[model samples]
Target: MKATNEIKPRLDVVSRAITSIVEGVCKENDFDIQYSGIESTDGLPVRQLPAIWDALKTAKARMNHQMNQLISRITHRWNLASSIHRLPAEVLAIIFQEFEPIPGHPDGDSSLLNLLLVLRAWYDAITGSPQLWRSFGAHTPYNIARLVVDHSKALPISVDWRPPREPPKRDLGKVLDLAIENSARVKSLTASVPHEGDPHL
Candidate 1:
């Protein structure tokens, strides 16, 4: 029973590895999968066209080649192979800090936070590091204000508000007020007001 249990786990691992390799190759090569049905000569449906069938054959061959190469490399480097997931939390945090976070990223900074929250070691390592949070900036929307407050780090703040081409009943004061309200830490403000051949500072 013990031997069988161990063998089962190994088989499961191998199966997952094979599946991953196959899928990875397919994705890299932009392979598409299709299903087909055999048909009779008597005006019955025939197998899928050359496009779908040929793509499947090519994809399978490519997948097998990739998996074989991966296996060879793993066997050659087995002694030095170490799972990335098992790396020291601090090292992983430093590695992750290399990726910049886009303001509208679907996962947001929450994605990195979730990764750090995976274990106590990661939490301590990530939370103790400040570089990971440096990417929180103006382009991140209103969430940046919260992040700055949480960090208690003063950032060089700049606000640029372009006023209308024609001055209305009210002047740039309203626009400046809005900028202040939104970005209280703003150290420098630049704005464009109506020219009308007149310049005011």
Candidate 2:
């Protein structure tokens, strides 16, 4: 029947009540139990042990559940009132753009993808902005490239399709082929090939 805010104050009262009941039972049984030796105590009757253990366990579980609920409520309220959450979606989109990694970085796509996991608002803002998906790096995978092209929604795109320095005989033609397929929407392109003298070429 009480509100969530009132539950915190009641925790202390519940704790004290449990302590008083425990101490009363110990006193009535004339048991001089030490904290570490509770399990070894033979002075307390076996019938009372189960009741005492069950009461402690139930109290611990209930208090733990309440604590978790309170923490979740606090976090939810804090996020709702946070400045970043208050920003307009356009502003958030610009912020996401600023978080974009420099081209050629091996973790560029993964780093940008992390921004999408931050919050629902951020995910919506980034996904709704076509400009964010208009750039592709050499390290970008073909499937991800396709996703970006689709999300770009007819907007001009930039591609950086540079071959790695050392040749492992790996074929990059598929990546380039996809890039070429999207060439109509290409605004800027950077390509690198092995030097003519290089045997890997």
TM-scores for all predictions: 0.31, 0.62
**Cα lDDT of all candidates, in order?**
0.49, 0.71
Q: Which ten residues in a row have the lowest lDDT in candidate 2?
A: 32-41
Clash pairs (backbone) in predicted model 1: none
Compared with the true structure, the alpha-carbon lDDT of candidate 2 equals: 0.71
How many Å off is the CA of 28 in candidate 2?
22
lDDT, candidate 1, 53-95, per-residue tens: 4555787798799879998787556523547546876787678
